[model samples]
Target: MATTQSFFRIQTDANLQSMQVGSIMRKVKSRAWKKQRYFRLQDDCATIWYKSKKAGNAHSTCKLRWLWKPPLISISDVEAVREGHQSEVLLSIADEFPPDRCFTLVFRGRRGNLDLVAESAEEAQSWVKGMRKLIENLENMNERERLDQWISDWFKKADKNGDGRMNFKEVQDLLKMMNVDMNEHHALRLFTMADKSQSGTLEDDEFVLFYKMLTQREEVLRIFQDYSSDGQTLSCRDLEEFLREGQLKQDHVQQHSMELIEQYEPSDTAKMRQAMTIDGFQMYLLSPEGSIFNPAMLEQHQDMSQPLSHYFISSSHNTYLMGDQIRGHSSVEAYIRALKRGCRCVEVDCWDGPNGEPIVYHGHTFTSKILFKDVVTVVGNYSFKTSQYPVILSIENHCSVEQQRTMAQHLTRILGDKLLRNALEGKGSDLPSPEDLKGKILLKGKKIGGLERSLDGVVEDSLAAEVSDEDDAAEIEEENLHNDSIRRKPKKSKQGLSKELSDCVVYCKSVHFNSFKHSRIHSKFYEISSFAESKAKKHMKDAGAEFVHHNARQLTRIYPNGIRTDSSNFNPQEMWSAGCQIVALNFQTAGMEMDLNDGLFTQNGCCGYVLKPAFMRSVEKRFDPEHPEIRDGYRPVTLTIKVISGQQLPKVNLKEGSIVDPLVRVEIHGVPKDQARQETRHIDNNGFNPMWHETLTFTIHVPELALVRFVVEDYDKTTKNDFIGQYTLPFSCLQQGYRHIHLLSKDGTSIPPSSLFVHIRIKEGT
Candidate 1:
């Protein structure tokens, strides 16, 4: 067990053997009602018990109400645990309890809250500390251990006979639980295969083997058959045909084919035969040295100690919504999903709620609302869960002063020291490095007096006078709320920030943009500004170099314009080209843009922080996005890829019994006109394993700025072709060999081991 400082004196009793810590009175469904329950924490789960009285003899009885386990009991599960008053300890569970009594633990199988009232503040602190320590320890367990525990728990649940083995019926139910739907005949065949002893049932070891078989794909054998001529082995002639037809240049085809054959058939006896067996074919495809995506790229480390402003941060726009901006439901799950996928920056639009709380949602829209406290709690729990780099909470505030105070209080209490309440190192002239702010949360929003005081502390008097004038204007606006004629007059602009919340603004203070020149003159290290995609593009077109130079010293965020009501995303590469660190996308929506974003950030350890290119980082170097000749640093190259064959290409839009005519389209996305391309040709009818001995080539002028995308689609003449799957990679990362390209869904998730076999070659000049 991991050691942690105890909040109170450790209680040692005979009951400790049963794992029972203590008992307390818990508020039930309503605050007025209370129930007494004893809780026990075990290695894998926590259990609750009830005290029973029989003939004046009191004893503790097991209450099989609910079980809290790892994965399910994530960091976000326990929302907040804080002292309500002197003896009352408030606890909040995410989306499990009633809104009126959210400060209670709602078990999975039970209703209402477990808002326990500890004997004293010290007791409450002890319970909270114990629970948090248990959760943290569970989270810190290695992946293999967690997987083993999960598998063991699942096996126990599915083993209905309690015989430590699973029969056919139980196996069927287990498959259903795993969300795998297989025909009865196929499932029985697999079961029999796994039961090597013919015992009519599967033990734990056999069950694990069966599970692997169910999920594993036969991509290698399928592709090997496609390349073999006699349905047994691939001869030298077969290899030559596969390579020559794959679009390899005539000058290079003969030499490359001979080299591959000699490499696979290394022995003199095998060389005399000039053939590659099944084992050799498998080795060539599965070997890291031959794979299209170099495994070494993932191991290559980059600098992680750069300043926060010197990196392009993976960010999300409207992080609370999962669908259409106007009517989408606001959910804490969105934040969890985004953070888990390496989103370092998240946006929250706060408004006043029905009670004294502040809620997050799209303002002035019909979207659903979630508590601001809930969002903050979720962020605090998940901020460093994926990446230890700092998380920026971009706030769009529209709350009144009272609710703003509630927001500040909840954030401070829930986030604790993780929240940056003040500038670090006494407010340096430059922003802190990512290394300095690791595991911290920075609040970014319009702050009252932030700009004035940040201006060398010399504008304090003028800012004070401006604040007085603003307060007078606010009083007049309040008076006009009662008069008809006065209300008809133009309303005064409301203050965007509250004094209480402003104190939390440390490094990232959102500011309004006036002009490029004006921003350069007034912007401070702590100040950041956002621009709509359209406005940012306009500025880039007008003063591209100036904007680039400005972003070198400070931070600028670019988001999709307001016209994207459907929650679509803009091409983030465009904004990234201009040195904008925070290129916020609608993470809820997935498309080519998201794919590109995923591909770019797939490097740098997917830590949600990638250092800018040297040219972009240097003020002296002039790297213009519009004109590449000014840099002249990139070289022209020809990318030749052959669409050889696909293994278990998923059915795309065809009926259950119908077959699909699969075709591969190769796309090259780059900055120059000659480099941007879409070329498609070959199609095959075999859905399980289709072979198309065709090659497509693209000549790219700027290989550094290019991306190679391979899309698999179902051919249809009547309507548009259906998307099956795709794989996109940076041009710089593409490996040249007989390689396998693993396919991913439109949402950028790996589609099992389904893959396409291709031979790629990159030549020096167009």
Candidate 2:
């Protein structure tokens, strides 16, 4: 069956200078055992042995030969050995030495002898040189091919579909196995680059190109250059090597010697821009030779610390240098920059623009313009790390309800599948979708008790548009709207917390309602000069921050444990009995205040007097000295309010059949002198009472049965225009016989002495 007998031959001098070619084959194979060896060629001075087989196969056949003419070394082997040697430190002679002159090649276990092709020694040497050169070239090409094959193997493993190609999904899963995390956009970007044909999959040749691009140094030149300074090579002392070694150097290790070795050589910052993740670098090596390689991947070196180097920078603008020179920063840059700096949460302000697009801005009304949708555009296009996209986009919506919903839809449309789909597909179908993110997103809206709007519609709509093929598609869209609405009814607060909060708090109270004398006194010590005191408070609470209130109504919304409260007027003992800790005191109170009191400070936690040297001494005497009741603290008190009266509060109704818009009118009143005095002086200190008589009317318009609330809290409270008695107001109306509001904690405990419970019924034709 076999036309030619295949075997291996060993050659040496008559003096037996070498015993076996087995050792040489073993040495060559040792370095790349994980890789397959499809071809092996071994040669001695007078004889040659050759083996060829596929990768992953252990057995190979060998043919032995002799020179019919004078033998000469081939230039191909010379080049192969030369290239291999130069690429590795261990194979130092690979490039520099001639393989024919150095050693012989043979098969490990094959047994045979060979026919002679050359006669004279000189002729044989010349013949061997020529043949060896040809063989060397073949080997060199094969080695390159072998590397390409390795890349193909990796691609196939990642493909998962056995399609001989890989998509973004497959690459993503493979990256996970390698402990390399990549975002869907980034993964797709890389996959698209490797796909070449744009087939959404990578073929073997594409895979080979990818493999070559990844391992090749061209794309990662800048990164590697960054790690190496003054042309000094990365060695055992480098952080990567040290991490691999897992050995810590002793403190006594000589810094002088290391420095003398050019460790102190200035590193080029420009070069650092060239660096990329090792994975990215490897992927570069897999790229096709002629294709344009995007070196953008090697843009940051800051996160490449000691052990695991996972950071990749795809563009220059998204990169943050070691110092403050942000590459491409606009006013919107701060938000994204914060994420690059590793902030887990960020504050974003949103407003409805003339175009009705949601835009980001810190100002209010159209006069202070910033588009919310623009912020989304910047973020979606310019994320540094895929995971960093999860960083909270804290939004403060200072607009009307319809506008707010429209803006939310605007965000959905802009971010769309690019941002939401990848995040959703990566998750289980059983979980709630984007609709669940509505209230969870920490957006500021008009809700009295910090009510969370149902995100079911938003989530269902987002998911309805995009779903993975693996998911059940039949009933998804059909059930989305209806099921979402049913699932979306405002989640009632657990136990009695929601009910209790409803009872005590007023939904719409203003600082102007407090007395002028009290307000003046309050204004003099701190600065709460605005009638819209609750605006900042609302925003802060939405950001998941804890707000402390000076009054019971403002303090009524504390639902979580870690948030501390310090009341100035309420019975500290009574509040303590109500599970509140820390009693805060007001500095505006004339005489001696209680000791052990945690004094609430302003925004910077620095007494306003700190900005001026003249008042510093008085501040020091009152606060810095060992005062009995005043302790050190810097928490700001926040207040939330709602308006309750409309018919009296104005009431209108719409039945399932009737056509009348529900109307309610609420008057916001500033705190008066009596209430201020009562709060400042002890409640038992004579008949001092604070009354809120001045009213500024605000209107409420909502669909029938819409559970609406107006949440107010103070973010910037100063002593200047301070409101005394009550701060927050909360109310909800239903066309029924009885109406009541209650206040409860984040846990479920109710605070007594909330607002008064009222009952009302209107006749058909009043």
Candidate 3:
């Protein structure tokens, strides 16, 4: 019996050695002490095993908690891995044994940095090479390869039986992992469908087929067919006709058609194909090589040092609610989604909740409530994930003094050093720039005893002095009657704010608006005023130049008026033209206004901040959106776009059978006269690759203030045309020559490879 056990133990040790690249005795700082651990790199992941101290033997049991896998293990996650590093006292295990010859690995995670040391330089070098190779391989994978790898990893986890098959229970668990919650009956039906042999289990191939079914884009294929003249293919001549006039006199149209056919057709063919098949069309639509979003446009090399007021900030109103403000589900997901989409300013209406904690919700409404602490935690984690620009927490305070203090504590503790506690530039006379406040959170709300004391005191004293000067007896009687009437009306009183919470309002101290003249004299660097849409519009109409000049220096936030109960959005371009930085919108709603907002900020790297136009930024010049032709250096420009072809256009309705009548609309939004729109004639039954070869042209006076929007809609004789997909971009960013316009869903997510091929030309006009 002893001989048999010895043989088994020898075999196990041999197998372990063969599987590992290298193993070494390392002192790892697992809590406080430096314990000797056996570290090894095997199968792309690093494992640390605790050495048994009693027997001085390496154990097979590993510290499973220390294993790192892909998606989490990225090149950016590793800070440094050095060989022959000098002993660092801070991370060293013992005082006597200096780590001069040891290999040190430094990695960063959610909590903080972690350091691991190897016993010798050779062992460290081996581990570092393995880890570096793994990270590089993962990062270099294309989108399709990455998706395949993820699917394979998920399959391994789901196949619990170890026989390459999953039962109904396992399949249900897989769906849960995919975040799909289906009824038991539905899940059973799906399982049975995948289990062709009625064996009550799914094989590996069957599982893959099921996954493909879940991810297949039938709508895209249907739309492709809608564009094709023949059921199987789309002709290049038709494509050319859709992009330009059918006349043969236009040389550019013929050149564009030949170039597209050569680019999209299969190269293996003996001769250049005049048409594209479904497979060729689909591949062209989904590849990133065909993407229209220029990578150079998203580079973060722009100067972010301008004051917060100098940039147009992407702001959201009622950010806690996902639907209507009156009856919506308030969740931290709203804040997360908005921040991840590069929104810099988010509104949080805090009201008193159970216990001393405050909760965020719409007051005097039926909207659901979320804990304020949870919202802060989400903000702390995701605020800088998408963009390094500063975030503004627009707090609408309705909490009591104690609850407000608790809110402050939550912000300090959860945000830690990320919160901006004081002026970034030592209380300078001017507002600090966004660059100076990067990775910091700013609190914007009312503060205690921070109102204009001089203005308030003077008004109160004047009223008292005038009242004391009443001399005539009959006048006294008349004054008494007036006083009785005034006493009958309810008087407004100011509420006290907690000093602890008040100190957090260093820059964006919310204040009430008086008049244009008074605000000019009283507004300070630290104080910003909010105005409703109507009020702001009235100011612009009454004094356009003054309002433009005021916004050049002071920060003004314009929100939707009370009448917009449906949470609709105003045309942000009007406010942007006037240099208003924060044009807060109802992000939950989707419409033309939202499209314009998304387009304007799509430039400048989509950092949620964009530099104002030169004329709007200049203090000497006064520009008006309504009269752009009067501005100096403004000239008329003609834009010609050829609607040539579409690849994998999405069907507007899944239930409208397999056929669709698709059309392309060219919308030019700018000053009233320049806002011209036209749509091409709808093609019957073709959805896959449709060739219109029609050209549309427009002359606009102000290209700087114009947004060019490409919309794809499905025609229906019974009702209004349904929207399929759209792409919007600033006219300034439009590239000349033949280019593909990638389509985006209504919610601003890229629908891969679905694109419109067009030839765009912009020429200076009269």
Candidate 4:
């Protein structure tokens, strides 16, 4: 029942006529009204309602086409847009203007041209007031220069991003800014005409071209005839008059208005470019200043702005040697302390010591008695008991292949799952080869392609295939037959893998040849490692196997998964780019201590950081504060407990059970041995990895314990023999119950005797 300009209450009963209004209303679901459009209204006399400001123009009225359809533009948008119009228009719109929520306007000029324009009823009323203001401003602005300044200001309002030229999106945003109701597609078409390149960007010249095009398309010239005060200077109010006259019509003015607004939107390519600038890959190369494709650099430093999966600190210099102190004071403990302070990784070279131990020495001969086991122990002590991944303890094995295997076994026995413990385990079928470690937890440090065997000399390929192919249904019968046959000649084997073979083996494993994706391993290695791959391919498990690039520079092409990295040197940025899962912090790549201000201990790959004691100490000093409860509480607390496994326990399960596992024992270290011992409670029997037993839970009795320090020992309970692998947890305790007291003598003397016992040289007798 509502009519267009329904508020006008036309006195004439002009029969209703059909008006062809386009679908200009916004989609119901669009919250921002970005998809809204305009519609027109007409009557039986073709005497359409047109908005005009010719002195005493009368408001016109028309009927609705559909029975229940309401006004095209809502009242809110009309009021919002009108409010943004100049202050003078507000007063005029409030006066004599008849208001309604929906309406359409039609205008005719001397050229016999009819233009149809539509606005919400509220907008129709607002338009009359705005038109009146435009006429008044044109009349008042006697100076053309003032008018020009106003037009420039209006133009700037439409140009967003402050680039001085309106693009399609900018125009759409401008409409939204002013709350003018319009649809997106129509807005796009309107602005594209001045976007001469069709690139969706509008330059000042293009915008000017659009302005001239608008001047030609509408009957706006008469409205602005008196725009210039001195015949040379046109006021902005005159420009508003021109725009208003062109816009309020039944002609092609709406299309022209849309074209003008299209110039405000930015092109798709510009948006894509903006997205690229904010991405991780581009940010990574921003500081190095050139393509990072160099093939020979062992290590390269990256700037801080790069987007990394994890945060890290870089070494001060690219190729600094580590632990070169002349005295016998060099220790992995010192290196770890520095690492804990903040460095993510540290590197060290390994050579065979006199006892065949892998020691920290770059030279062919290992001079320092410190072994690789010592290094792993220090690192595991620092990182275990935290959610952080294992810290990288990269060992550059410069010794013979046999010695490399020895080093690997030693490291594996030391770190458990708490360190990137890489070692070539064995040469025969009984052990894991360096290559097989790719899809698995064990890291192989040497060359690939050779098959490693277990101590029993049984080939791993046959065993793996047998294990994979064996049917679970044949369990009882097979176990009986196998036990009868193997009782006479039992064998045990272990093998090791190198970084290259590991990568190839990992890639070839767990993939189907008939699938779309092919493994990226070199074809030659694929043919050679086909046996392991065949068994792995058949069964969907490839444990800790992962691909590792032979060189660091090859990381330019890899996407973001299934890889680990090891090299003589480490570049956190380059390694992360290459999709390396872990970056080995070798002591030789850079010293643990460089610039105190620079955070050298943080990791770029994962949350794990590997460090020697010295490095860990520095990190602790810098990041961890002293216990506020204690006088000088900021110092990092160190707690060490030694657990002995393989010990037998008496059985009685209580809700608060005290039964100890028969297989383990504890040795508290670093803290006052007695205090650490006092804190030891329950013993747990779980392994970190399903295959290996590494961590155990014990209760702490003291509320003030800060850090835990101790050696853990596990023994063969039945035989009472010492378990091979031992570890320590250091500086991982929070200071909750710690308290300090001044020890005083009976006479109130400040200093007490070094020994608790009083030296009773008691003059004769007490």
Tens-digit lDDT track of model 3 for 443-497: 8876544433212211221221111110111232333444432223222223346
3 or 4, which is superior by lDDT? Answer: 3
lDDT of 4 by residue, 1-766 (tens): 0112232232142211112222233221112222233433332111223221122225534432333343332111121112121111222233422334322221111011111122455444444443333333333432222223333434566765676667676766554432233456765766787788787776655665554443231111222244434443223333233334422223453443333223221334423332111112111111111111121121222222211211222221111123332212344534443344433334445555666665664332122445666665555555432223323333333444355556656555665443333333441212222123322232222233333222222223332222111121123223444433322221222333333222322111211122112333432121111111123222222211122121111111111111111112222322322123233333322211121111222222212322222211221232111112222332432332222212111122222212222232333322121133332232343111011122333332211222222212223357543221222222221111111111121111111110010000101111
Give candidate 4's error at residue 193 in angstroms: 74
Q: Which candidate achieves the best TM-score against the true structure?
A: 1
Candidate 3: lDDT of 290? 41
Separate clash counts for every candidate: 0, 140, 27, 160
Q: What TM-score should be assigned to candidate 3?
A: 0.61
Candidate 2, residues 1-766: lDDT per residue as tens digits? 0100011111223211221121112223223332211111223222233333233334533543222333322222131112111112223343533333232221111111111212233333443444354444334432233333234434545877665566766766655543233356765766678787888776666765654443333313443355443433443244243222211223432442243223222334322433233333222222221011112212221222211001111111101111111111123333343333332234344444575555543231112333565556555543433222222333333443345566556555655543322212432312222223221212211222211112221222122212111012212322443533322322211111111211111211112223333542442211111211133233223321111122211211111111111212222211211111112222112111211111111111111100111111121222211111232331211111222211101001122221112111222211110011111111111011111222222222111101122111111234322111121221121212112333222111122112212222222211
Q: What is the lDDT of residue 239 in candidate 4?
A: 27
Query: Which ten-residue region of model 1 has the weakest summed lDDT?
Result: 1-10
lDDT of 1 by residue, 373-441 (tens): 889988998898778889999987667667877988998999999998877764468788777889999
RMSD of 4: 34.5
Whole-model lDDT values for every prediction: 0.66, 0.27, 0.66, 0.29
Model 4 scores worst on lDDT over the 10 consecutive residues at 753-762
Q: Candidate 2, overall lDDT?
A: 0.27
lDDT of model 1 at residue 485?
34
